[model samples]
Target: MTELVRATSGRSEVALTFHGAGDLDITRQVLAALAQHGAYVTVLAVGTWLAARPDAAKMVLDGGHELGNHTWSHPALSAYKPEPMRVEIERCRDELVELTGSPGAFFRQSQGQHATAEELLEAGKAGYSRVLSYDIDSLDWRDPGPAAIRHAVAAASAGSVVSMHLGRPGTVIALPGILTDFARRGLTVVTASKLVS
Candidate 1:
């Protein structure tokens, strides 16, 4: 498999990947914001969350965004043993397949930015050839102010996969301005797969 992070220097695409496990209403607003700017993103969803909100899969896909497995319960992959780790990856994989007919091209380990060695093994077994990690973290999940979240993500450049969250109110508030900044910099927001592809 290819290494996850790319060095596509001339590429204009910067991926805004949302760790999905939030209220349906919040996700709707996030999707609406993306729609307003004609941007696409990658949502790495937890299986338990996906199963709880069955409509979320289609909601994301319908917005021309991508959905990938983020694990079942979103525990730290490094803390899991082989069997449970395998289950964590595959269970979400199964949910994606059942809901969307295709498990997305990416898998991102939860509770961390980088993948664990064991997480990589489980991701491969679950048929994800690429694992998406981020270069910029918005830190919106911590309830930082919208300006602070905007400042954090405003650093995105070409080939950047910025980490953000769907459930974050600050993220929703900051997204429009962040998109404007990206547009100002000539950076196009695309799905993580598209950023590398």
Candidate 2:
């Protein structure tokens, strides 16, 4: 199996990970916000986004960012059996391949849960080598306030994979600040592939 090349530069690095939750507006804002900084971003997109919002999917791909599968429907992988899990993963991958014209080589399992290594193998079989397992939990998934989001990223370090959601306003509001903070600390903000490559 081809292993996703992780960044071993030994310099302090961090990946700003965003899980795309069918939110085109948020994704657009994020891309625009990060472009000025030349930040490398990883966006995990759901299969439904392709059919329901192709425009959003196109926007993400057009940003020259790395896209990863987030499954057909956003559900915990631990909730389903192997066949169903495989189906979900593949469906998302195939849809992404069709839409973006690139087979998704990375994945971020729904809710960050994988019951076993077999699941990782399944991902590998589907041509996904890099899987994002977060290091910093922004808790933005819980609909927290901006202060909380700011506080969490402020504590990130090199190689830290920050979990964020485009669905949350707090996260969006906090992102610009986070990027500025990363700059102030002399750390390069990169994609998840950079962390585990």
Candidate 3:
């Protein structure tokens, strides 16, 4: 599988990936907005988030989008020793597999940090084929206004993997404009797997 920082699809399509570790209400709003646009996205969910709200994880999959592992508690895997790093990756993979009945297709490092060589090997050992990083970060975590969020997403080009968060209300608020911008640019927003595949 490709090590994806940006999708390399030969089409005017991009992936909108949401990191799910924060507010559930905002997550629901984000999902609803995507559904309204008839857009499918990838959600890299925290294992603990899924454990606390399996229903939300189900909601993502049931909506016909893809869900992926984002570690157990959003820890920095690079800071940990090898064994604990494996646990961080594997525990999330296991939890997602149990909840979804399949090991997810991709793994994203916490905070959009690229995995180190050793960490990448650990991810492979944990059964993940691709480690997803992003080309465009929405910076929604800063509680930036909707306009700023829209501007960040607007800068994404074709085959871009745009990082966003489910924890922030600004992201939810910016969804309509983001979708509109993509549509206006004739860029179809697809799930990350679909974009890469």
Top lDDT hit? 1
Once fitted onto the true fold, the runs of candidate 1 whose alpha carbons sit more than 4 angstroms away are: 6-9
Q: What is candidate 2's lDDT per residue for 1-197, written digit by digit as tens?
A: 33232344667888877787746777778888889788878888888876688776677667767788888898778567788888888999988888888766477778753325656777777777666566677888877787888888887887677778776777778888888899999888877766665
**Residue 13, candidate 3: alpha-carbon lDDT:** 97
By TM-score, how accurate is candidate 2?
Answer: 0.89
Clashes of each: 0, 3, 0
Per-model TM-score on C-alpha atoms = 0.96, 0.89, 0.96
TM-score of 1: 0.96
Q: Write the per-residue lDDT of candidate 3 for residues 39-156, one digit (tens) a residue.
A: 9999998899998887878889988899998999888777888889889988888889899887787898885456677778888888888999888889888988999999988989
Question: Candidate 1: minimum summed lDDT over ten consecutive residues — where?
Answer: 1-10
lDDT of 1 by residue, 15-53 (tens): 999999988999999999999999999999999989999
Runs off by more than 4 Å, candidate 2: 1-8, 113-115
**Residue 39 CA error for candidate 2 (Å)?**
1.5
